[model samples]
Structures are given as structure tokens and as C-alpha cells.
Target: MEGRKLFAGARLRNLRQAENLTQRQFAERLGISTSYVNQLENNQRPLSAGVILALVDGFGVDIARFAADDGDRIVNDLHEALSDPIFAERRPSRQDLKIAITNTPDFAHAFLTLQRAYQAAKDRMASLDDALQHEQIDALPLPYEEVRDFFNYANNYIDWLDRGAEALATEIGLEGGNHLKLGTERLRGTHGMSVVFERGTMDPDIYRIHDPGAGRLLVNADAPRATQSFQIWQQIALAEEHDAIERILDEARFRSREARSIARIGLANYFAGAAMLPYGRFLSAARGLRHDIELLAERFGASLEQVAHRLSTLQRPGARGVPFFFLRVDRAGTITKRHSATRLQFARFGGACPLWGVHQAFERPGEIVRQLAETPDGERYISIARTITKRGTGFRAPIRRYAIALGCPVAHAPETVYSDGLAIDRAEDYDLIGSSCRICERRRCPQRSVPPIHGQISVDARVRRVVPFEIS
Candidate 1:
């Protein structure tokens, strides 16, 4: 592989054009003839080590631009898209797919977009069919999903809001510990807002509520310390950063008023998290502690879920932390929250892979379960999951239980404490995971709920397997 030559003609051409260099000018800089440069740019000739070094030294081009081609990503996405049963017979070969992606990237993207729309439409039709049986049809573009997609496309980080929150934290003297007290003080002093905790005053289900007319913010008396502090910061964000929040909302152009309103709340929650864990200090602490969630939660007075969510938002340019995927699931295996900075994407309409450690975390609450997982696409990740329980006040009160999972690519596993005793190289220790049963291609999985789309199933009367039928 090392001796193999690299041919990235399109990328080389794009880079040269970006730098406003012509074939003659580029050739002079790289100590090559114009014809040779043209040949390389046209991919008639493969890129050599000398040319790569010359490009790096002469033009300061990022080496990764050539090393990690977007064509590969396009190919992977295309392969995944084509895996649907609809195209089972017409699926292109790997080399053919690579050629399509490399030669016609725009057409490839258009095809991917069409496939996504088809999938979305299929999902909606299935829901509609179900609704016909139940006689209930829900609205399109669900508010929660809309907000989730908004954050997903933004990579779970809003630079402006993050920086503003950090500045506000500093102004409120939230540094050097005691963030909850500082948050409370800021809400009271800066916003002229009073924090009130009273049992049975507000809705029993509502955690926090603000009454602008009364100039008071009421929180549930039984709320945890982290929840109380988060509510305080949320209030501050709505009061002090209302203009900024609205500005982003305007730019977002959300389709519905409900979505805009929900997004505003989500943005405020983002601000609260950022304020509670100031970006600079939190990143420093995370690196120093090797991203120990428990230690960070204890040090920052945050919940494990909060720490995990914050870890996924460390996509700040030039000071980025490890790209992590974060997810939260309830006891019934419903994914409550999800964001991935890595290549992994959660199921858009169904439960996650049963083989995932997050599902198992419910069996052993308070314990961090780690697993090396490989997706169907051959990407390996190091995942860690733990159950988070929120206790209720009264004897008969309902308690909230959720499990949060955080993971990054296997290449980053060495930097985290969870990987200390694990053998990442052992295939037996690695769990084979996927997005969902319907989309997963593992034919022999015992836990599969449904046969994969387009899969052929055969049943033999004499054979009894874990699954009733064999899938091919």
C-alpha cells in the first residue's frame, strides 16, 4: 500500500485553482515542467513522493487534502445508500462506485440526496399506514427531530453561542469552582430575576418555568443540584442572550413556529451547558483527566449526561477535542438524544443496535461499560456507556432512568481512561454493531428483530437456529 501511487487529479486541480496558480506557475513552484503538471492534474500520471513534498513545502498545502480524499467518503456513503433492498440487484461494483464518486462527485451527492428522500418517504408512508390502522396521523417534521437535525448539521457546536456563554461565565465569576452559586448570583444580580423553589407551586412535570411578569423563575423543589444550576443558566441565556438567540433563529429559518420555539429552548440549554463548563477550562480539564466523565462531572458539578453531551460539542476549530458520538436512551430502548461528531449515524426512525453497550448499560446501573465496536462499514469505535438515574421525591413518585453513551474512533481510544485494560485488537472482544435491524446486514445476528430490507430468507424444518430463518 505504501508503494502504491496516489492519483488525486481533481483535488490537485482544485487546490491549484484555490491558490490562483496556473499550470505554468504551479509547475515553476514545484520544480516541474508545465506538461508534467498538466498530466498529473489530469491524473494521466500518479502523484509521486517528490511532488507531494514539493506541494507541501512550496504551497503549504495541507497534506491531508490529498491523503484523505473525499472520494472515499462519497464511495462509502454511496455504498451504504445502495445497500437498500430496492437496489439489491442493480448494486454497482466497488471499483465502479469509486469511479462514479471520483469522476462525478456532484451526481454522486445528488444520488445520495435522492436516496435519503426515498428513505424518508418510505418511513413516512410506513407511519401513515400505521396511522391508518390507529386512525391518527401526526404532523410532519416533528419538532424534536427538526431540532436534532439542526444540531446534527451544525456538528453540535455553535461557536458564537459557545464563546458568548464562556464570556458570560467569566463576567458572572463562575470560575474557580462553585458554578451553581455563581449561576444563581448572575440570574439574580444581572437579570433582576429571583430564583424560587417551591413544591406544588408549578406543574409537577415541569422542571423550570419563568414568569416575566413576576420577574421570577420557579424551579421544581425536588430537582437535582445539576438541574437547578442548569435552570439558572438557562434563565440567564433567555434574558441576557435573547437577541443573539433570536438572531440565530432568524438565520435558521425554521419551518414552523413550534420548531423555532423548541430550537430556542435547545439553544438556551446549549448555552447553559457551555456556561457550566467553560470551553477553555473544560477542554483543559478533559485532556488532563484523559476525558474521565465521572471526574469531570465531580469537578464541574455537572451530571454525567451533561458531561457526555459537552464532550460531543468540542468541535472548536484549531483546539478540537476528540470527535465523539453521544447518545442517550431510555429503559424501553428509545433514543432520547443523539449527536455524532464521528462517521457513525444513529437510526433515524428506529432503536439502536442491540449489540451496543448502551443497551446493556441498563442492566448494570452506575457502572461504565466499555466495548470496542465495529460497524457494518468496517469502522471501529471505542464506546463507553453508563446509566443515569434521577430519583423522585415521594414514595410513589416515578423515577427517571436513562443511559448515556459516549464514543470515539478506535484511533482515539488510547487517549481515554476507559481503554486502559481493554484489548482493542482482539476481534472476539469487539461487538458487531449497526444502526438498526432493518438496515443492518448481519445475517446471523441472534438479536435481529426483522430481516434486512431486500434480504432473502430461507427456512428449513430440520434446522433450528437462534433466529427462526436464515437471511442471505
Candidate 2:
């Protein structure tokens, strides 16, 4: 495949300015001509391979720093933000947005921050309206929202906590096989906590409970084997890695005590997943299998959701896997869990696009549904979805169902097993999807639930289509 030309004039200018070097000085450091540096900084010339090498060797600059296409991320986010109803008629063009981002990145970032604050405030107002209807207005910012924002800002990867978990896994010898037995043994030998499986002994609502007085960890027998193993690992993380987890929480400096407590649980869950799949082995296995979730689950004794969630956390600096976005949605399309190493952010207020294959996964239980999706800003992704069912204790007990979706950019599709036999190059094969209907700009979508926020609605007595009115 031919490589695309890299024209990062703004980034080059920013780097030079940060080092307090003039164009001639920067040229001298890079061993390049002043005119060539001027041309590169003005976007008249693309960054050549020799210049990149010079920049790396002469200044010891990290190559990955320049490799990031921050302009694309900024453009995508700006497009989403401007799709709001307030800018329905005065949205900026794509070229204008690119110029704004390239010429003034700081201003673009400040604009994005203001837009995020607006969205958050809008969400709070909606919640307040709902509360007013029920005559109960609680608070401004919820702890759950704070926790979600914390994870989102961190790109869903806690590097220190992940490394700590990896070290703990090495200490416990959790490598070769039978990870479940290894976890159980570690808990019993190191923590002096006996594992007990008691059916109907604990509340059906709780999956695992630790009894300090009895010196036992009680797991619900109704849970699956994978769940049982995960519960054991979670308890081990809470008991053994309490100090490390507390240090992370302290460093986080969450706004509220409740947020800190919730974050502590989240960090424990991260450690449990890391301990169960131990970074090196899991990454190697994933690459070998081309990230087949079921096969990986079978190999690692993990659930499908666990395997998918683990894939999103493989951003360990030098040993990163393919960046993926993972999401779990219930039947009503409510997103229960979300994480993105990609640019695709989930809508904060509503369900995902109805056109997405994740909604179809519920209809076909246990089957992996594959889709080629294109976002609003022309980004293409290969998405795979499968329904996961959780059985209750008794025959009459209600069963819970959820569909998990995992996706990556089309450029990375070749690295996944789900992309096999897919017509990735065919544009017609890709479904045009967006983050949400309110923000979508697709005018004539048959599955649209509501009029687009940035579209003009045209109603006529003579004409009628799938929708009640035409969007202009």
C-alpha cells in the first residue's frame, strides 16, 4: 500500500516555537535548508522521510509524537459539536473547520471544551426537568458522570495500574494455563481466604461477597464459570493490591468521596482483568489469533465481554495492540458500558445509531454480526457484535441480555479475524451510520427516529415519504 503524504505544517510550527527557535535555527538543527523549512512550515511541501529521520536523530524527538493525526480527531469532534440545533443554519464548512484547527489549534481545543461543558449542562438540565416532573431535584453533577468523564479523559487506560497488575500477575506465576486455578490458589495461599461456592446462600442480586469474620469469599453458584473466576480475581485484587489501588485513587484526586470510591472499584476491576489475562501472554495470543474473541475466551478462560474489554486496554506504550472501541448496549439501546481508543465517542444522552449492527445482535442471539460502518465525517470502521445472555438462579427468574460491540478503523481491519471475506473497499457495502439521530446529518434516512438537529424540516401537503417531512 502506498503511504499518504504527511503535511503537518501547524505541528511543525508549534514544535519550532516551543523550542524558541527561528526557522533558520530549526533548519540548522535538522540539517535542512531554510527555504525547505519555510516551505514545510507553510504546508507548501509534505514532510519527507529524510526530514522525519533528521528530526528524530538530531533532536531525539519521539517519532510517535508527530505520527498522531490530531487534526483528524479535532475535525471529527468539531463536526459532532457543530451538529447541535443552535448552529442548524450556520454550520461551518469542512475546509473552514480544517483551516481553523490547523491555524489555531488552541482556540479549537477551547471551543471543544466549551462545547463539552454545554453538552454536560444540557444533560443536567434534562435530568432536572425529569426530576421536576417527579417533584424531586437532586444535584447538579452526579458522581457517575464524574467517574465516566475520568475514564473518558484517560482514554480508558490506566498505565500505572495496568503495569502494577502485570507485575502482580508475574509474581503469582499466572502465565501458562489454568488461570482460574492459579487465581484461586493465590487467594488461598497469599490472602488466607478460602473460596466457597454456595447456591442460594447469598442474595441473588449480589454476585460475590467477602466475609471477614468467616475468613471466606462466597461466590454465587448460579454465576457462570467465567464469572466465578473473575469474582475470585476481583476479590484478590481488592485484598492484595489495596495499597496500590489507594495510591492511584489518591493521585486521581476525584472531586467527591463517592467518586473516589467508585473509581477504586473501577480500578479493582481493571486489575482483575489484567490479572486474568496477563498482558504479555494475552497480547501475543490476540495477535496470533487475529483477535478472535471466542477463541481467546476459550484459551484464557474468560467471558466474551471480558475478552472485548481487555482488547481496549492493550495500549501499553511500546506494546500496543490495534486501537479498538468497545461498547455494551442493552435491548433498549441504552449504553451500559463504553470505552474508546478510537475517535468514535458514544452519545452521552441517547442510544447508538439504530443502523448499527449492535441493535441487530439482540435479534440473533449467540451469532456474531459484522458490519462496515461509515461515520458522519467519512471515517470507516469494521464492527462486530454478539449478544450475551445472563441466566438467573431459578427457572422463573428473569434473564438479562446485552449485546457487546467492538470496532476498529477500516485500516486495521486486516488484523482482525472478523474482517475476513469482507468487501472493505466497496463503499456500497458500508452502512452510513452516525453517533445519534439528533446529531446525524443524513437527510433521507429511513430509520431516523427524529429530525436532525441541524437540518431544515420541509412539510408539504402534496408529498409524503418514509418520514413525515423532508429534511433540507
Candidates in order, TM-scores: namely: 0.77, 0.77
Candidate 2 Cα misplacement greater than 4 A, ranges? 1-82, 86-139, 175-177
Q: What TM value does model 1 have?
A: 0.77
Q: What lDDT is reached at residue 93 by model 1?
A: 80
lDDT by residue (tens digit), candidate 1, 1-472:
1455678777778778888998999899899999999898777888887998998898776554244444544565577678787788898987999877665655885686566567666676776776566544443466676677678766788877899999877776785357667777777787888888878555546888888899888888887788888888888888888999998899677768898999999999999999999899899999999999999999998988999999999987557899899999998899999988888888766788889999999989899999899998889999999999886577766788999999999999999999999999888888889888877878889888988875789999899988899996
| Clash-forming residue pairs, model 1 | none
Worst 10 residues of 1 by lDDT: 64-73
lDDT of 2: 0.83
The number of clashing residue pairs in model 2 is: 0
Residue 302 lDDT in candidate 1 = 90
Off by over 4 Å in 1: 1-139
